[model samples]
Target chain A: MVTEQQDYAYNSKIEGEVVVSKADAVINWVRSHSVWPMPMGLACCAIELMGVGASKFDIARFGMEVMRFSPRQSDCMIVAGTVTYKMAQAVRRVYDQMAEPKWVVAMGACASTGGMYRSYATLQGVDRILPVDIYVSGCPPRPEALLDGMMRLQDKIKNEKSLYQMKKGREDPDHLPTGPR
Target chain B: MNFEEIFSELKRKEAKDCDSFICEGKDLVNTLEALKAKGYEMLIDLTAIDHGVEASPRFSTIYHLLSLGEKNYLRISVDCEAREEPVVPSVVEVFPAAEWHEREAFDMFGIKFENHPDMRRILMWDEYEHFPLRKDFPLAGIESEYPEQDVVERTDLKVKAAPMAGGPFVADTAGPMSQTEPMAKDQSWTESKPKKEA
Candidate 1:
């Protein structure tokens, strides 16, 4: 009977682990690359976020083209546009629903700092609600900027200590700050 | 019906702009009914104007009506007094489209649309205390505590300071084009030039 580990081991040998020498490194490499993004498009910046996934600046080049609308299926939340005060609750709910070891990318000046709308309705920044991992600054950032933000997130994921530490951080409330840090 | 016919029928004051009438709050629904009978089927827009704190009859609900059949447009203004709880007769009975518009007006200016089917806040959340668009409402917004954190306190430090006395657009010195001496010469050339035939 061929075990699951043996099957993967056989496949790894056949495929050749060129740079990913260790088991941990291979897992980290896969996790970093296969970051399924939850497109939380709120306003105008959503247009640029959509552009990043399009053919010209195809996000699939970095293996992040799988745009999942459901938070359960995604590992990253790309918050695109002005998160209004009215919509902040929904944003927090979506962020909370996302699976552990999740990352947030505040994609635009609006999502980062509410852009030029210093009005009553718009939320100041998304970071007040969710612990944002990356911030791409622009009124509405270009597709290239969004791609760069994704790559930065990938780098952060790559340098993560270990799966044990990540799981431990999720399980232990004391390990991580409860609210926005 | 044409603007003249509607004006004579409703006995409304002709607005400064052509094809517009200022209808009293009492005559609003009746005027809308008369206009609807005249084939003004589309409610183009419904908005309110804040006439400041001390102004009598503070809010004026502006309704733009369009007659697709006749390819004509009409603007109607209805005045409502600014009271602790200002009540205005809803035109929803005449036009079903006025439902959301009335709700929005209610949400922004705290104007109560009497007999509205669902008189709830349209734009702002239900829990939101103040009508944000009202003149009395602070431009920055009211202080409200969030479940996780105080949003006002968190954002206080992050708010960027406004530019110094003279903004970036303010010129330090007048350019040659901005100078009155050069502009006088250029004005004649622009004004004397014959209007281009469309």
Candidate 2:
């Protein structure tokens, strides 16, 4: 579908840049092309996760169709539910089990702050147990919102920081952001 | 019967601090039995709420009773202690729906339903440290991580029955931490030994 001139312009741009390391190129390509997500849907927010998979949203366009149920195989964990005290430890364990370079996205108000259902058993937010890289704020976010979060996570991956470094930066008590999400 | 009649009768019984025929908790059970004697069936949801600020009893239990034959609805409520675990008599034998509703209250409010078949963690995992729904508990997880020494000492955490609240939520049997075996576990960041400064 590319015209001859369009292809030439693309190649010239690539040639003008300094050569990228083979490993870095592969990693860049992989980060964008395939994002294996773990959809940890537990509450009403789970319905939004479903919307992201449906044809209207078509998350498959981003090549993130395969949702790994086992924590070990997943590239990132999307906490899409109301986490309770009973569920916090389990969430942390799953985050731990995920291989290096894993990401976590906290989806919805309930997962972020217990929402209106705040109660004795409801853990206020998931971030206490796992470091949340991106937060999709909504009572339950729209499908596009979830996609936006994933895209932001992709940007985080492009930086090439180890998962531990990224997590520690977020956890640093002194560096907490004062601005709104 | 009209609410006025019930209210007057409750007033006569000298139920202290009684207000406007709002029958709750133990009083609710007694009223339900009296209503059942008059042939009522079907108990609806059992729910509780936490008022968040300190009070003598910072919790309330709500019970809804229905009569299919007569087509009447009655609501009863009781104020009780917001203990780490509040104990209320189970109405499961009286109505099946109460089983799950009580469990839900326990799961969310940390209320304990006495005589319930099971009483354990419902909405949360087994190793979770604090009851989150309590007004005092932060909406977020507790500020500090589980201490390393605490994990080491918990080699004998017991496995209990599933919570009475009947729902899809289940405790991960293979929990994040093994209740029986702690020595073999890796030191998670929450419990990691502090780094040595140069």
Candidate 3:
């Protein structure tokens, strides 16, 4: 099984072609702006995540209203709760399902470090299974914080001319993710 | 243990090892038992943490131990170091109700008891990979199942079918008419979907 870090490091193999021109930047921008996220809520933070989607927070401003139920169609995965060892593999599989150029956002402390359940069951962070692009820090980050993280992600997207090309030197298909098999 | 007596005894013993009190996690289990021997048996609830931006030692478990006899309560706590394995002793043997409560602790916080008899996943399936209750556990949850039809359907139909038609009122559908149907035919009802006309 692919451990979380291995997915982001220098060894992940590139199975697809890289997008390497100015045009790629525009496409990436469109994709990033029109993000269709999968909100996989687990704990209390889920409530806040709902708030972000609620009329008050209105995540639709970022075009993430699709809130995909199937991982294959989502552009990014926003992990909003604690991830236990039992759930780690499943998270990885969902990450795998999303097509190329997919991103992951670790939304809260629990998604970042297993929050309060630092024991035998919970995985310290979702990063242990999937690559995280931006981290929104909070027990449950305020809706404003989530918006800021999205803006930062957009900034990151704007700067990159090619998502695949930027990821070039780090590709290694043969390398397996580093956690439990 | 009786809270009044324990408090008074604790004061007299001046247990130097015990200083300021902050109840937490599994420690509350032992503290409760020790208090119960003194007569404290009413447990209030479990409280937890979601340490964010505070720098490590992310979560804390709080247990409220109370006694109906003396009508007193004491708080106990255990700190789960960030990214560290948290383990505490079992109080299940002491309190029968603790069995389920401890399981909830395990299911949510991922805290493990030293000698839990059935130390398996309770809320998340055995195959499920995360302790969902932890503050840092991903919100998107683990990926394997997204509202699995079987699991969600079981409970959801009971709830959803109430307000509207096409609800999971399968038995209600056939009701008296189905009872008259042959026993072999009745077995088909167990299938989630209705049989298609050949």
Best by DockQ: 1
Q: What is the lDDT of residue A136 in candidate 1?
A: 98
- The DockQ-based order of candidates, best leading, equals 1, 2, 3
Candidate 2 chain B lowest-lDDT run of ten? B155-164
Q: Compared with the true structure, what per-residue lDDT tens digits does model 2 show for residues A1-181?
A: 9756544343646577665565655576687568788988889899989889888998898888888899988877899989765565567667667775577889988788555443445655666556678999876898899898888877777766444454776688334321122
* Fnat, one value per model: 0.24, 0.13, 0.00
CAPRI-style docking class of model 3 based on DockQ: incorrect
Clashing pairs in 1: none
Encode model 1's per-residue lDDT on B1-198: one tens digit a residue. Answer: 556564554445656664777777787788789888889989988888778787887888889999999898888887886555677889999999999999999999888988889999998778767887878875656556543344433332232221111212232245663352211222222213532335
How would you encode candidate 3's per-residue C-alpha lDDT over A44-141 as one tens digit per residue? 77788888888998988887767887988887789888875556556776776776667788898889866545344456677656668889987778
By DockQ, the better pick of 1 and 2 is 1
> For residues B1-198, could you state the per-residue lDDT of candidate 3 as single tens digits?
434455432322223432325545434556566777866676576545546435466666655667678676555556665454567666667776666676778777777766878777576556555666666654434334423443232222111100111222233345586363222323342224544445
Off by over 4 Å in 1: A1-24, A170-174, B1-16, B147-198
Off by over 4 Å in 2: A1-21, A109-125, A161-181, B1-39, B47-62, B76-88, B104-114, B120-198
Cand. 3 TM to true fold: 0.44
Write the number of the candidate with greater TM-score, choosing between 2 and 3. Answer: 2
RMSD of each candidate relative to the true structure: 11.3, 14.0, 23.2
